[model samples]
Target chain A: MAIIETADLRKVFRSVKRRPGVGGAIAALFSREYEEKAAVDGITMSLEAGELVGYLGPNGAGKSTTIKMLTGILVPTSGSISVADLVPHRQRLENAQNIGVVFGQRSQLYWDLPLRESFALLRSIYDVPRERFRENLDHFIEILDLDEFMDTPVRQLSLGERMRGDFAAAMLHDPKIVYLDEPTIGLDVVAKEAIREFITQLNRERGTTIILTTHDLADIERLARRVILIDDGTIIFDGPISRLREEYGTHRTLVITLADSYEDVQVEGADLESREGNVVRLRFDRRRTSAEALIRRAMERYALSDIAIVEPDIDSIVRRIYREGYTEGAIGSPS
Target chain B: MSVVFSRPRFRLEPYVEFAKVAMAKEATYRFDVFTNIASVLVRVYILRTVWVALYAHNAAPSELPLHAVITYSTIAMLMSLVMDIDQTRILRDSLHDGSIVLDFTKPMRVPLYFIANGTGEVLFHAVLMIPALALALFFVHIDVPSFGTLAVFLVSFLLGYSVGFCINFILNCTAFWTLEITAVQFIVTWITDLVGGELVPLVLFPAALQNVLVVLPFAAMFSTPLLIYVGHIPPAQYAGALGLQAFWLIALGAVSVVMWRLGARRLVSQGG
Candidate 1:
């Protein structure tokens, strides 16, 4: 069964229309003009237990809005959502007990309290049993290596330490699902890897359903097997990572270095993209010709000293999806 | 995994924990505590001196004795300290920075959590302000109420605290609509100081203004309790004064509840 399900979820914000300058400010008070903006529009998706899905969108693309609705922070204007068998907005407190939320730019821990105290307070808020709280605490502490700075005040801790503390606080109740919004944003590479590894372990061992929204493609690549792409408040793409590659990531580059300078170097089923002295680059569709076949043909035509095949990186694929909308042909394709 | 204890049913445990954490957090700002005490002392001194000078200049004796006015000023300062709600800035900051979304996601009502946290800060200030109150009493002569009146005063003070919290909660709810709450804060503080009898005792006001102000919720927050404290409220009117306080407490509390519900809905819809 799906741990979270949303059908045609939508949220529209109505803002007062204000004119510019002093006269406009005065006019605004007297005149009631409103403009409606749709932050999340007609999004339908579901997440099964232990499934890790990355929700990707550019800035102001409604990624956070959808997460907010799912977590019950914002009520939807239309549609229905069921998280952990509870309607989040209608049963907010009950739903809150079963889900955890983390935001990269925000710290949920009390500013002046030590990390340990914040965790204890969260435990109380969630009503986790004392022993269960301890078990989760010990487990996260050991896994995240929080012993070193657990006693430090949250405001005094470094960004990485604070994020770690926030993660532990969110999970203290052993919530059934966790929503991570840009969890690794603004962290160093090492810190990012640590968080990614922790997320992977959490999903593998605890069956925690995760909905990750991040700008960092590495986070999506390392942690999420499934991807849900949104743009302008609508879901544009939903499929496995491999399908994303197979569809938009069709072009592959093969670079070959010749043992000796050849005036004529030709290969079938591959376009000679560029040539630089003894080195030449060829482009071919992965669907049409294999890298091995291209290389075998290149060897037959010229003396090859070295060869390298470059497939499209996930970052580029995601960027392309954002720049140019994904086609409907990519949906529901097998990995 | 080892066998673990089952999760317990939700209770007031979280609010108590929030209160404890808030108290501990306030304790860290020692310099702020000292500054608050100094400011309160300075304010008391200024008000006392102004009243003494006014009394000296008056050709006719004032209705309230000089001693009684001094006592009102002193106790009003102390009452203000105890009844003050400290979550205004926290609310504004949270809303401005969008952390309020995370706050709403917690397993507690936003108003209750804030009230609990603010109460903790009030408790802390109440303890620390004892010495300051002692110093104020040394400088002014205050008439002690009878045991019955004292009991009435304590009840009035509790109601006053609730009134103040409701007012503060309502004001803070404006954060959902406007990000810059400084103007709202200033207006609220000024009006509260004027109408709540924090700056001038309600007894000194014109008879008509006093009649009107006494029935307002602002009077319940400061003037009602202070009147009971200094024996200014007649024994016959004691029940009426307490009843007025209770009325405002319930009425303002209901208003706060409505405002909170509407404001929370606005917050969610507006994507705060």
Candidate 2:
């Protein structure tokens, strides 16, 4: 059974329509005009226990809004949602006990207190059993490497250190589900890898269901097996990361270094993307022409020193999807 | 019957823990504490000189002589140390930064958490009240009431503190709609200073205005307790005065609850 479910969950934000000039502003004071935008428009999805899914979206794509609703920080304008058998907004306190949240842009640790003090406060806040809290704290400290700065004030810690602390703070309660919003944003490569590894360990070892939202596709590539892509307050695609790669990652780049200079290189199934210093880059559709077929066509036309086929990275595929949007085929059937 | 019997017990541990954290955080700012004590002492001396001059120029009222008035003003100044703080400032700030979502994710009552945190800060300041009080006593002669009056005055002071907290809390909740509340806060502070009986005793006001102002919640916060301390409100009328404070407490508490509910529903947290 799905541990979390939302049926047509929606949140509409109503704001006053601001006028342009001082005259219009004064007029607005007398008679107000309100404008409404649906931040999350009729989103419906479900996550089974122990599933790690990436909730991906562009900025203002209602990704955070949906997470907020699920975490009980926001009340939806309409529809229903249940997490761990409790309606989040309605039974918020109970739901809070079952879920943990970490927003990368924000740190929940107290600014003045040491990291250890924050954990103690959270222990009381969640009413965690002392022994269980200790065990979990120790586990997270080791995995996240928190012992070195445990006594340092949170404000003094670097962003990477603070994020590591935030992760531990969110998990010490042993929440069955965790929502990570941009958890690896603005981190060095090393710190990013550490967070990713910790996330993997948490899910695999504890069987914790996770919903991760990030603009960083690398995080998705490394940690999430399933990806749910949304844009304009609607789900455009949902499936495995590989399937996302397979369906939208159809284009391939073929690079060839010519032994003899060619005036203009052309292949039947490919377009010449660029060239410099006897090296040529060509873009082709994998479905239309295999790499061998394209290479055969290219070699027959020109004397080649070396040829290389580049598979589309998840980053470019996602960027293209975001820019040009996906076709109807891009949308996976509801699970 | 079963539902009532099976109702969950109220746990005080979390609030106590929050309070402890707040205390620890407040103590970290050692410089702020010393500066605050100095500021309070300066205000105490200035108020003393002003009151002495006014009493010398005009005949003092029988019920509220110069000494009684001085006691009222001195104690009111000290009360403002703990009472003037915007206890729910964290709420407004969190809303501004959109970090309030983190607060909502915790399995705790946000309002109670704020109250506990605010109380902890106040308790820390209450400790500072000692040295400040001692310093002020040196500058001005403040009459201490009898033991019974002092005991009743303490009870009245707690109620007044509740009244003050509710007023501050309700005002801060406006951030849910306005997002920027410095202007509202300024206006409220101005009005509170005028009628709160902190700067001047209410007994000195005109008889007609005094009757109306005494019933206002502003008076309930500072005037009621100060009046009790100075023996202006005698033991015979302690019940009525304390009852008025209690009534305002309940009334404002209910209004704050309503405001919080409405504000929370419409909260447009600044950004993620």
Candidate 3:
């Protein structure tokens, strides 16, 4: 059964229309005008327990709005949602007990207090059993390496250390589900990898359902097996990460460095894109022709010093999906 | 019936925990506490000297003599310190930075959480303000009230804090609509200072103005407690004054709740 489910969830934001300058401001006070913006327009998806799904979207694509609605921070304009068998907004406290949330841009811990104090406050807030709290704390501290600066004030910790602390803070209650929004944002490469490893281990060890929304494609590639693409407040694509490659990610690039300059280089099952000096670029469809076959043909035709085949990264595939709307074959593919 | 019975019991533990954390956080700013105490003493000294000079210039003694006025003013200043609601600024900053969304994710209601936190800060101020208050008493001729009156004053003071907190809470709710709260804060502070009877005793005002101001919630914040402390409000009127304070407490509490609900609906957190 799905631990989190939303059916046609929608949110419309209403904002007052203001004219420029003092005169416009005065006019607005007299006769008000409001503009309606659909921030999250009819999004529907479900996440099974222990499933890691990446909610991918460009800025202002309503990824955060959807997460907010699911976490009961913002009420949806319409539709239904169920997390852990309770309506998030109506049964907020119960839902809060079952789910943990973290935002990279904000620190939920107190700024002036040491991390240990903040964790203690959370323990009381969630009313976790003492033994269980200790167990979870010890587990996360060891995995995230939080003992080094556990007694330092949050304000004094570096952004990387603070994020590690936040992750541990969110999971201290042993919640069944966790929502991480841009958890790896503004971190060094080493810190990002450490966070990703912790997330993967948590899921594997505890069966924690993780729904992550992030602009960092690397986060999605490393942590999420399933991807849900959102655009303009709506779901554009939902499938496995590989399906994104299989459908829109069909083209692969081959770059060859030649031993000597050649005027005409021809190879079957591949189109020559460009050539400069001793280097040549070729594009091919993986479904239609194998890279090995094209390489053999290229070797037969031209003297090559080095050849490299590059598969399109998830970033480019997502960019393509955004550039060209999701094709029919890519829509609603089984994950 | 099952839904009602199964509903979780409202627990005070989390609020107490909030207070504990807030007090710990406030303890870190020891320098701020010292500065606050120093500022309060300086303000009291300046105001006390000004009141003495005014009374000396007037040949005909006022209804409240110089010593009584000085005592009332000092107590009012101390009450202001206890009733200070600086958490409004914290709430506004949280809203501005969009960290308020994290607040909403908590199991507790925002208003209650703020109140609990504010109460903790007030407790801290009260503990530290005692010495400054003691020093000020040595410099001024304060007529100590009877034990019964002192008890009444303490109760009124607590109610006044509630009223003050509600007013500030309502004002902070404006952050949901307007990003700038400084202007609103300035206006509210001006009104509170003028009519709350912190700077001048309400008894000295014209008869009609005094009557009107006494009924206002602003008077409940500072005037009521100060009046009780100085014996200006006799024991006979204690019940009526306490009743007025309770009325404003409930009225403002309801208004803040309504405002919070509306403001939360309109809350468009700036960032994702």
Candidate 4:
């Protein structure tokens, strides 16, 4: 059975019409008006058991809204959702036990107590058995390398340290379905790598189904086989990560080591994307012609010593999507 | 009815977990607790000094001895610790920071969580209060409660706690609709504590006012419960106090629960 399913999920929040400044404040003191804003607009998604899907979108693009609905934090204005055979908002407590959440910017750990105390508290909150709690704690502490700071107050820990502690606290209950919103946001390279590694291990070892929303493309590249790209409160694409690359991301750039100086080095079929020192970069879509073909043409024409192909990265793809889809005008596609 | 585990109830697990959270939180803010205890003590001293001068120096009527007034002041001081919720602060914080989203999703009952949170706070305050009372005992000839009086005190104390919790619940739900209504809650808390006897003895009120308070739960929440400890209200009056407390607790709890349901349905957060 599918672990999670939703049918046209939507959430509408009422915006109170408070007047501006002192005049609006006085009027609001006497009377208030409101308008309705649709936060999550008619979203429908389904995930099978044991599938780790990456949910990606810009801030306020309804990623958190969707997750909140899924976690039962906010009930939908319309439509239905079922997770683990229970309606999330209707059966919140049931979902809470089965699903764990980690908001990247927030700490779930008890800030005043030692990390161990927060773990112990969560053990009782989820009612994990004593042996199970100990087992999970040991594994988490070891994997997260928290042995040195297990006794430290959460308030005293570094952001990376605190994030690790939160990771442990969320896992103490041994929940089956995990929801991570930007879990690697604002982290050092080592910290981000550590978190990604832990997430990979948890899904592989424990069969924990994960729904991760991250700004880090490497996270998507590293762990997520499946990707769900959202924009303007709607899913624009949902397919394998590699498939996203294959479909809208086949363009690669050719960097040629110019044997000598050449001014106004422009190509018709291929664009002169960049030039630095003795090297010149030519970009062309693979569908139009392969990177090797472009490099061959450049070499035949210009005195080139060495050449290397650069694959299209997430930054370029997202920029292209935003520039074309979100803004005015479209990009020159495969043409 | 079997109260323990007849079903998969939200039970007291969250309460227990929240207790740890509160304790750990209190440990970090240990200074705040100390300052709070000092503030209560200062209020006690201010009231005690004024009343002592009124009775001992023949400045007031009825000759209610220094010890009697001191006992009244001490009881009011100790009870004040139990009544420091500041509902307005809670409501304002919840509305502003958007952390209320955390608990709104839980399968557990919302009002029950609020009550449990109050209980956690009471547990912490009760610890400091005991030592404060013990210290006051050394400096004053306060009347200690007998076995029967202590029993009445215990029952009435729980009732008082329920009353305070209900009032807080009703007041906090006001935040659902109102903008910046912390002043409203602060006023209500001050009136309840001062008028119902957290500043001085409720008996200091006019005879008519005391009679009116007898029928109200706010008085039962603070004054009536503490009177049993100070040996002012005898154990026999305990039944009447308990009866009044029961009526008010049931009435206020029911009203607050209804308000919570209505308020929650109308809750509109400004988040996407």
Candidate 5:
């Protein structure tokens, strides 16, 4: 059975549109307008145990909302969801007992408490036996490099240290599934890498099912095997990471360096996008011709200069979805 | 599920965690344990001066002694360390920053998490009060009467804390429905100080006011219970006052539990 599943799960919000000025504000106190926003419109997806998936989207794309529903933090406006046969937001305490969650933008540790104390508190909160608690603490302390900051209060640790601490805190309960929302939001590159590497290690070593949301493409590339892309509160694409790179319909950029500055260099099979002295930038379609073919054509035409190929990145793929619109990954893969 | 009482330090674990956090949190600020002690002492001294003037013309206090009144406010500062909670911030933060998502996914109930966190804060403040209470010993008048009175005082203080925590929790949990209520808390606290007998002993009030105050949960959470321990009330009356604090604790606790159930179902996980 799938570890997590959602069918047509939807959520909407009504925002008050109060008028401006003192008189309008007073009037709004009596009568105001409300605009409906579908934060998480009808959507469905399922995940198996031990699968590490990246849930991606632009700002306000319902990435958090979807995670909330799965984690039992949200009650959907319509449809149904089951994480381990329990409905989130209904059997909240039961649901909480079965899953673990991590929010990159927030710290779950007690701000006033020492890092070790926070762990000990979690140990009791989850009712972990002392033997098990000691074992888990030892493993977490070793893997996260927490010994240096273990005695420091949560409020005293640096953001990177706190992020590492939070990751360990979430996994303390030994739950079957884990949900992380932007677990690497504000950390430095090295810190982010550390957090990502830890998450990957958890999934591989422990077989813990993981759902992660992040804006950092490197996070998705390194950790998530499957990527779920979303835009405007709807899932635009969901498939293996390799598939996303394969179906990419956008053009690629190629830059060629001439032996010397070439004047009035007009090339065929590839358009000269930019020319600065000896270097010439070109735009071409991969489906239309291979890199070797395009380079050969350029060589015959432009004094046989050196060539460089730059494939489209994730940012442009996301931008294309916004501009041109997507059809297949709107909800998720069928069944 | 109740802790089987076999789990070692299970109950005390959260308190220990809170002490660490409180010290670290306090460390970040311009903190001197003496300054805090001085501030509390200053408040007590001013109140004592006022009471002395009022009693100069009148040699005797009503049923409540002048010494008892001083003792009441002297320990009243302990309430700040125990029950002065700000959990609405947690509820609001979870809703706003989406950390609540992480909490809801945990194996612990949401209200229990906040309660546990509050316990940590209280214990942290309790350690903080050691030196402060010691400093007040020199300038403040606190009569224990007997060692047995000290034990009774501890029991009464705990009951007061339970009621205080449960009441503040219900109010704080309401923020899940409508975001900010700092103003509401302020008004409720001021009323409790004025009429609930935190600032003045219930015995000092007129007969009609005293009756009304005792029947209400506010006094049960603050003054009447504390007075019971100081030998101000007859030992036979301990049962009735203890019953009041327990009843209110259960009542307020039930109300908070119901609100929590509703709030959890109504969870609308916002911004990522």
Candidate 6:
């Protein structure tokens, strides 16, 4: 079942045209010159129940704007959004009851109060049943390892600890869907792993639909099977992670180390990418020449001591796509 | 489902809890509370001295005596402890910082939460007023009105507060159109201090102008309650004064509701 859906969703922000200098600034006050930019332009998509989808994009790619509309914070300039069978903007209060949101850069926790007090206040705000609230709180405390610093003020907590508390707070009411925007923006390896584990558990155990927007590719790689890639306010790609890899991730890197130093080393089918000391990096298309064939050519040409073929990671592929925009063939059309 | 038949169920628990949390947050800064009380006391003493000096020159009229003026000034200062608090300051701050988006995602009414938070802070300052009032009483002699007058004053004061809140809310809503409102806030605060009868009684204005000024909402917020307390407005006119306050409250309340809806739309459209 599709738990969330949007058709041609769009959000346009109209701002006064700001000028360069002090004189221009004064002129703008009287002039009504306006410029409109569509932040989320005609995005159409749907999410199935219990699906963990990575909503990926670069900065100013309308990722946060889309999330805001879905969360009913930013009303769309046009188009329709239905989350849990209700229009999010029109039925915002009802939709809010069914959704949870976490903005990693900003915390919803009270800064002066302990995590416990924040949780207790959320309980009243959501009107969660006393018994159920207790159960959820205990579960989150155990899972997020929040027992040690539950009484510490939010301002005093480390980023990781506060994030854990935030996750718990957003989930206390058992929302049917969760929107996590950069949930792991700034965290150490262990903290990142803990959050990813918690998110996976929430989606799998509770059958909750999750739409995660993150710049961190590792977060997308680990938790989301399906990914939606958007840029310039439109959907460019939408499918499984494997399809993303197959479409844009065709380049392979071959690193060869030579025991004997040669003034010049060259392979016929590969282009030299980079070199450090004795080791040389070569880039080649996987479709044209196999790694085995490339290795055979390098071995015959130079006295190689070690050779390894590196598959293109999602990071490099995404970086390349950003540098050179994707084609319509691999993209899902915006409805 | 008929809309008229189906009354919306208003939840009070969330606002109550929000107010409580706000109170708790306000209590955390104990030193600030003490400093606030100290400043109010200092101002009261200065006002008492200033009024004494002004009366010595017989600049004041016979209808307003020295003791009555002292009571009026002292009560205005005390009333300012709660009334001067901009309940919609949180709204302005949130809009500026863009944290208001999180508030829009909440299940409850955003304005109500701001009100509860403001009420919590006002209640805290209201408690501080007790000590400040006591200290002011020691410095100057203030006339205590009869029990009936005191009862009427309290009712008028509440209406005045509602009117003040609506005005503040309406002003903060301007932030939706203009991202910055600090200059506007300063201008409005200066005007309120001058015309709201906070610094000087409206009765002292020219009798012809006094009638027009009293009908203004600014006077409804400060002058009505203060005048009622000082018996400048007699028993017969209590109903009239309270009724005008009620009128302003409803008028401003309706304006605020309209402004709030329009402002919220602007905020969401601007992607705040």
Residue A275 miss distance in model 2 (angstroms): 2.4
Give the alpha-carbon lDDT of every model.
Answer: 0.84, 0.87, 0.85, 0.75, 0.74, 0.87
TM-score of chain B of 4: 0.86
Interface RMSD for each of the candidates: 7.9, 5.7, 4.9, 5.9, 7.4, 4.7
Off-target runs (Cα >4 Å) in candidate 4 are A18-21, A276-278, A326-335, B1-7, B20-46, B56-60, B63-66, B85-96, B104-114, B173-181, B207-216, B226-237, B262-272
- List model 1 lDDT by residue over B19-42, tens digit each: 877787788899989888888888
lDDT for predicted candidate 2 compared with the true structure: 0.87
lDDT, candidate 3, equals 0.85
Docking tier of model 2: it is acceptable
Cα misplacement distance, residue B179 of candidate 1 (Å): 1.7
Give DockQ: model 2.
Answer: 0.44
lDDT of 4 by residue, A48-81 (tens): 8888999987777789988888887666789899
**Better-scoring candidate (lDDT), 5 or 6:** 6
Ranking by TM-score: 6, 2, 3, 1, 4, 5
Scored against the true structure, residue A303 in model 5 reaches a CA lDDT of 72
| TM-scores for every candidate against the unseen true structure | 0.91, 0.95, 0.94, 0.88, 0.82, 0.95
Error of 6 at B6 (Å): 12
What C-alpha RMSD separates each model from the true structure?
Answer: 4.6, 3.4, 3.3, 4.0, 5.3, 3.2
Ranking by lDDT: 6, 2, 3, 1, 4, 5
Minimum summed lDDT over a 10-residue window in model 5 chain B is located at: B1-10
- Retained native contacts per candidate, as fractions? 0.65, 0.48, 0.39, 0.34, 0.51, 0.58
What docking class should model 4 receive? acceptable
Query: What DockQ do you compute for every candidate structure?
Result: 0.43, 0.44, 0.44, 0.36, 0.34, 0.49
Query: How accurate locally is residue B257 in candidate 2, as Cα lDDT from 0 to 100?
Result: 87
Top of the candidates by DockQ: 6
